[model samples]
Target chain A: MLYLGYCRHCGAGLLGLRRCGQGHLLVLCDECDALWQTSDLGQPPQFPPQPDLPCPHCGQSLNGPTAHWASLDEVRQAGWNDALIVGPGGCSAASAT
Target chain B: MRPGRRSVGLTLLGFGVLLAWLVVKPMLPTGPVETGQVRPETPNAGPPASVERPDGAAEQAERPVERPIDSAAGALTELPGDVWRSPGGLLYGPGSREGHRLRHVLRHARDDPDRPGEHGVFDGDQAAIVALIDEAYARSEQGAGRVERDGPRSVVTVDLQRRVGYVGGQVGRRQGHPATRHVRLVLEGRNVITAYPLRP
Candidate 1:
């Protein structure tokens, strides 16, 4: 699966970007369910990321989740479609790396 | 007239009377009508404000005032169904993308080793959860909650001040976290992204 970044807190779940209704971008961790608002869509969230934000749905602190990587389909189904990787070569690069 | 013609004529007359009665009944006064009653003239009285009864009592006649209907309360009534359109024009149901989002929410319903802390877990079935989401959406639309922009989505939060669910993630259940009284609803344009109980 093409990953934008990894969860800063758990360092396990892959991170991706999702756009809100107003076109603002947010970083989402598929495994831990942590979400963060970001100014840049090109760069994924980095470690020591903003304070421990709660999951918007469950309101749980976004600091947990074991080494479980979410499937690409699950991430896409959850509205995380704005991956940093682009084009046909990007897919191969994501797979190669 | 022939007997058959006479019977038909009678039936038509009866039907006309019944129709007239139906139309006139609503216009008729519900209270007793006063007829042929006279009151003694009092000196310097320009007009009689009330009618005096034979027993020397005065009856005040006035139309009863009607109370205004509360439309908001009427809209908040529990509507039957698993799906509902929020006041803000969002469609929420299992048929929409909300189904996928709900899967993530249901994950917090139990204690999972991978997810820790007191995650707000819902305490009811899918129907009940949908109802809660409907209510929260309504409240948020009425400006009784918070709405924050998240790109192409909006996160709405409402505090119902009553136990709508419980906190029961891995460490939360062991710590005996209290029930949640708030709801967080996320919407993408006119579609519901997800909704779930919020930590108190």
Candidate 2:
């Protein structure tokens, strides 16, 4: 899977960034469906976190056990190789240069 | 004038009149002409207008002419199979990273890492999975599913309420993952990010 990081709470969950219709950048967990809002791409969660958005997969409350942001560096430290970049057109492979 | 000369003159006059009529006949409007109706400059310029054919049948001018499905050589005129092609070449050939994304999603068709025993698995082959994704995308385009934005990508989630595949993942194998009635597909833009069975 092309992932940005692994969920800190649930070690098995794969974490990726998703944008909501209102232009909110949300950190999402594929395994647990947890969610966290962030103001910037690949950055930590914003302070005074926004209200929890519904999980896109299950349509349930996104505030699960692993509802926190994990930066790219932390993801690399965790040994998840081939991490994708959060760009204007969603996740993409880093340029060779 | 002499009689013969007079007869020749009358005959000449008759021929002249016939020639005049031939030239003027085309200039004169034939049949009932509609005063305000203007002919379209282009074939598809306006709405369909009913026009009488030489066989006296009224046909819509806007209707496109139908063509035969087979060629004169008895070969199919169109290519076989679905017209849509995977932009990343996952299904066709010359594979790319998109294939990896597809495989990751298909993994759930066999096993759910989080809730291994509880979730079901998809039953069909890669083609079936791709077809389901295509259908979900169609429905999503028609506003049948939930649509969200992930960066510049569009994330569409569609729930197909039918038995798409049987349970056969790592955990479901012990229980003999039976046919599931509902399936959910998560698509990023036109690519299917992931798809798996959901408990009904």
Candidate 3:
């Protein structure tokens, strides 16, 4: 039940601010070496929009094509599709069903 | 001569005595019990109300209470399966029967939010995946049981116990038996979800 604010990529609790190559302060995760640059310090870094983005350290794909890597984006996409559909089982089921 | 007031008064007095005898008859003892006619013993009554309940029954009655769904969290809680809310505020469970049919899209839907309707795919979070699975399990259970949210694995697991009926083979032609069923569901907030029935 404890929410310790884990890093989404590596499940690590250590998130520190470091300067990226672009001279912007980026959030760095020590466990996976994932970095996120946010425009505002108060706001959380957005989910990476790039597909198949890899981890800087582990070389593992950060945002894969699958839902595992793209969960946040997937949910947001679902919201829009939900509105266009005439009913519940449309959207993804249209292709697979 | 016609009956006088004294005769009427005397008749009334006799009726009163008979009524009194009827009322007192049940409480009064008979002459004596017959030697051959023994009284039957009464069944022992249960213990008094103040007595403590048996530990097994007490524990069984004290199972954890299921919490209501959070309606504001989009379509995650709205799925049709059994739902478990982890202490970390993660909602998870298995997919419902109908939901299971949607596994094709559930497993392969791309996470392209920028393109939106072009992919004909819907984006989802771990909670959404959990909700889809949860909806599938709603028919099997009243609610999710033994929920776990593993941060390291980034997964949610729920264990459930159920009673299922089975038909016997040649020997069971005449009868059916019920067996206790146990199932475990594992979800990594993605398409890597799986469920297996356990030996009870």
Instruction: Write candidate 3's Cα lDDT for B1-200 as tens digits.
Output: 35798898889999999999999999998886433212211112222111113111121222212222333332333334544353333344433111221221222122222211111112243334334445435522454554445442222323333332122222123323223243334434532234322222
Q: Residues B89-160, candidate 1, lDDT per residue (tens digit)?
A: 455333211122333333434434323334465666444555677788878878988887745556677999
lDDT for each residue of candidate 2 in B6-80, tens digit (9 for 90 to 100)? 999999999999999999999997896433222212211333232323221221241222221112111112223
Query: Judged by DockQ cut-offs, is candidate 1 incorrect, acceptable, medium or high?
Result: incorrect
Clash-forming residue pairs, model 1: A19-B152, A20-B151, A20-B152, A20-B153, A21-B151, A21-B152, A21-B153, A22-B152, A23-B151, A24-B151
Worst 10 residues of 2 chain B by lDDT: B90-99
Residue B140's C-alpha lDDT in candidate 1? 83
lDDT of 1: 0.46
Give the 10-residue window scoring lowest on summed lDDT in candidate 2 chain A. A44-53
Over 4 Å off, model 1: A1-27, A31-97, B1-89, B92-99, B108-114
Cα lDDT tens digits, model 3, A16-46, are 3322222233344322233454313245433
lDDT tens digits, residues A54-85, model 1?
Answer: 33444432322211123444334555443543
Tell me each candidate's RMSD, in Å, in order: 25.0, 21.7, 25.0
Per-candidate interface DockQ score: 0.01, 0.01, 0.02
Candidate 3 scores an iRMS of 19.3
